[model samples]
Target: MKNTIYVLLLAFLTIPNLTAQDFSDIDKSPMDVTIIRNQNHSPMARVIYSRPSKNDRDIFGNLVPYGKVWRTGANEATEITIYNDMSISGQKIPAGTYSLYTIPNKTEWTIILNKNINIWGTASNYDSEKDLIRIKAPARTAAATIEDFSMAFQPIDNGANLLMGWDDTYVEIPFKNAE
Candidate 1:
């Protein structure tokens, strides 16, 4: 019985190896997540996005272009999950997951949150009708260069600010908890 059990276990492990599927190489733009918590340590929001490196490319106007909607990240559309209802641009937004899109310009950027999720890219089939919130954030040159496209949350008194940085540019979208 002991011999039979040992043989069965070996076969089980070997079978998996034999049937194992090949995986493609790692993504050029790897996925990442960022979360922000309140002072009490309660989660406020979460962002899942792919970070594309600068790779010595001109990001703002040349590569990303101007006056066009971008997926806001690489590969997959960037997703943000809000844990609480928030106010943006003096409008209330209910807590939920939304795809983040942006129109980049030299002066400012139009940031958008859409109801649609799981979108692969915005080049072909981005539906503007599903947009829930649209806000403008002034673009500023970063004091230091950011090597990768990155998203982060900066805590505020009422809520927090969603910050996106790439190359030498950065933008901030302010969010305040709805009273």
Candidate 2:
């Protein structure tokens, strides 16, 4: 009985891939998170998104397409969490997590915050009725071509500008805390 148990243990240990985990390769578009902190170092807002590289492709109007709603990132739709009640472009938005969508154009972009956030990267899942706010942000030519889609926060008085850039186009949406 002891010998049989030892043999079984040895077979289990020698079994091919019996304990090995098969992990997939890294995602083509990498996920990222950006956050802004207030004067007290408390988080004001957070953005969870994926960065998609240019890969020598024409972004903006070509790949991303103008006048169409974009996921604002890759894979899943980009998500923004407002830590407090805030005003975006002078419109009030309650503190909550929402999906961030954008309709990019040559001169400007329409930034949309929707209550639905559980959907993947597809416009079919986007319901206009679920939209919370739609604000326009002016677009401009970047200093240089940005190889990857990126988002950042630039501190401003009483608020911050959520900056989005890809290729040679960029836009900034102002967000001010109501409280």
Candidate 3:
């Protein structure tokens, strides 16, 4: 009877430790944040966010619609906080964290940088006049479907090309940052 009790106790004690051991490697995983500066010739800037394309049925059309405020990407709004005032489409945007949104259309997409940042995706709190900058860019059909929505800033001669893509469509917005 004592031997059986001892074995049972040993099994119970070892199980928890083994489970912990399995997750011990998780702490060693690489962190997902990368801070880049002076990138693509734009000074005084930072990009704190990016997200993958959502494959759900309600993503492009049901979730994000035509001539509506989209949270830019999945999850939280694809936020970009700049440390200094910047120029977007010849409009001045002060340094701060702004909620990025878009109104997608067939021929052109309007990118809106709203002053509100803590709200949910496409919340009604968005004000049109409060927008710091509004830029229009043409959209093109892609040969493939982008399973995940993605955004990247590519450096050009005097400015950065903000690229957004998903589900066989891509758009680019160019802005020259103030020096």
The prediction achieving the highest TM-score against the true structure is 2
What lDDT score belongs to each candidate, Candidate 1 first?
0.92, 0.93, 0.68
- Compared to the true structure, candidate 1 yields what TM-score? 0.85
* Deviation of model 2 at 46, angstroms: 0.2
Q: What is the lDDT of candidate 3?
A: 0.68
lDDT-best of 2 and 3? 2
Instruction: Please give the lDDT score at residue 147 for candidate 3.
Output: 73
lDDT of 1 at 70: 97
TM-score of each: 0.85, 0.87, 0.73
Per-residue CA lDDT of candidate 1, range 1-179, in tens? 99999999999977767766676777889999999998889989999999999999988888899999999989999999999999888988899999999999999999999999998989875899999989899999999999999999998889899999999999999889999
lDDT of 3 by residue, 1-179 (tens): 99999999999987766544455654221212222346544455554444554555545556577778777765455566766666877788787877778888877888888777766555665667768778888888867877767666677665567777887678987656676
Query: Residue 71: error of model 1 in Å?
Result: 0.7
Cα displacement (Å) at residue 170, model 1: 0.1
Tens digit per residue, CA lDDT, model 2, 1-179: 99999999999888896666766877889999999999999999999999999999989889999999999999999999999999997899899999999999999999999999878995688888999999999999999999989999999999899999989999999999896
Better of 1 and 3 by lDDT: 1
lDDT of 2: 0.93
Off by over 4 Å in 1: 1-24
